[model samples]
Target: MAALEGRGLRKQFGGVVALNGIDLDIDTDQVVGIVGPNGSGKTTLFNVVTGVHPATAGTVSWQGQDITNIGAHRIARKRLVRTFQQAMSFPGLTVDENVRIAWEQGRRGGSRWASPAMILDFVGLAPLGRAIAGSLPFGSLRRLGLAVALGVSPELLLLDEPGAGLN
Candidate 1:
């Protein structure tokens, strides 16, 4: 069974057809890429798959289960994770704290006090663990976003533009 699949997925914004009858299927441990021009529905497709936006038509399935209109957080809890085009980080939190929070949320029922050091080490941020996330360089921030997404150990990892803005 496919880990993620979409059939006849469609979305529109005031007559601007973002996606039109798109079909996609992804199995486990697959590396897939969707490339297109600026407005070629790339982000729209991710939005639909990640449940960030409701599809105007068609169905979305994960692990053979229908999730056409599921909520984003719920999807994340189910281990279908995605990162945004822009890097997202909690400015007020330390790098270690951010990773720790993600690690805790990923396990769903795990304790927060367990093995934060391990997560920091896994993301290669052990040295900067105490550093404030907002104070990091752009590249580091991007890596931090990846680290957070990895916390869930997702079956489907959607990276919008892992390398969008960098100097």
Candidate 2:
């Protein structure tokens, strides 16, 4: 069975049809990229699959289980996590604190990285762990977002525009 599957997925915002009849199957350990022009429904696809937004039609299955519109938090607990296009963090908190919270809130038993520090290191943000999240540069913020997603110990990670703020 595919690790992740979306069949006939469609999302519409009022009259705007963001996705139409999209079908995809991702196998275990497979790296897939969805590329399209601006406003081409890439983010919408991620939102639908990850439960950030409800699909207007179709289904999303993870490990052969129906997970469509199950809610984002529940999906995260299932070890499926995603990053946002915009770098997301608690502005008032230190970088370390932000990651620590992510780890605490989303920590499951099977994380590849053993701790929050490891996740920061993996994203090249260990040195700035003490810095306030709001004070960081754009690229660092993007990396922080990635680190936060990793802190959740996801079995499957969907990164949206991961390279957006980076060189």
Candidate 3:
């Protein structure tokens, strides 16, 4: 069985249809990317697949189980995680604190292969580990969010736009 699968997935927002009957099958070790023009249902697809938004129709199967319409937290527990284009960080927390929070809230075992410091370093935010999250610029915040997601040790990582605002 595939690690993740989506069939007949569709998402509609009032008058517009974001996704229309999409099907996907991904193996445990395979990497897949979704690309399209702005507002082309790419983010919406991830949103539905990761349970950030409910699918108007269709199903998402993960690890051989139907996981459509599940909450984001529940899906995250299964090691299927996502990061948005926006900086979804704790504004009042420090960069280091943000990484720590994600490591703590992550799955039963957030692979100790790398520490919080290492993850921050990998995302190029190590120097700002002590900086306040709210005071950072947009690009820095985006990196912080990515570092947090990496701390989760997700089996499936969906990044909305990792390079959207980078220079």
Best by lDDT: 2
Better-scoring candidate (lDDT), 1 or 2:
2
Clashing pairs in 2: none
Q: What overall lDDT, based on C-alpha atoms, would model 1 receive against the true structure?
A: 0.84
TM-score of each: 0.89, 0.95, 0.94
* lDDT accuracy of residue 59 in candidate 1: 94
Better of 1 and 2 by TM-score: 2
CA shift of 67, model 3, Å: 0.6
Residue 33 in model 1: lDDT: 89
Is 2 or 3 the stronger prediction by lDDT? Answer: 2
Error of 1 at 45 (Å): 0.7
- Candidates in order have lDDT scores of 0.84, 0.90, 0.88
How many angstroms is residue 107 displaced in model 1 relative to the true structure, after the best TM-score fit?
2.5
Give the runs in model 2 whose Cα sits over 4 Å from its true position.
Answer: none
Stronger candidate by TM-score (2 vs 3): 2
Q: For every candidate structure, what is the RMSD over all alpha carbons to the true structure, in angstroms? A: 2.6, 1.2, 1.4
Clashing pairs in 3: none
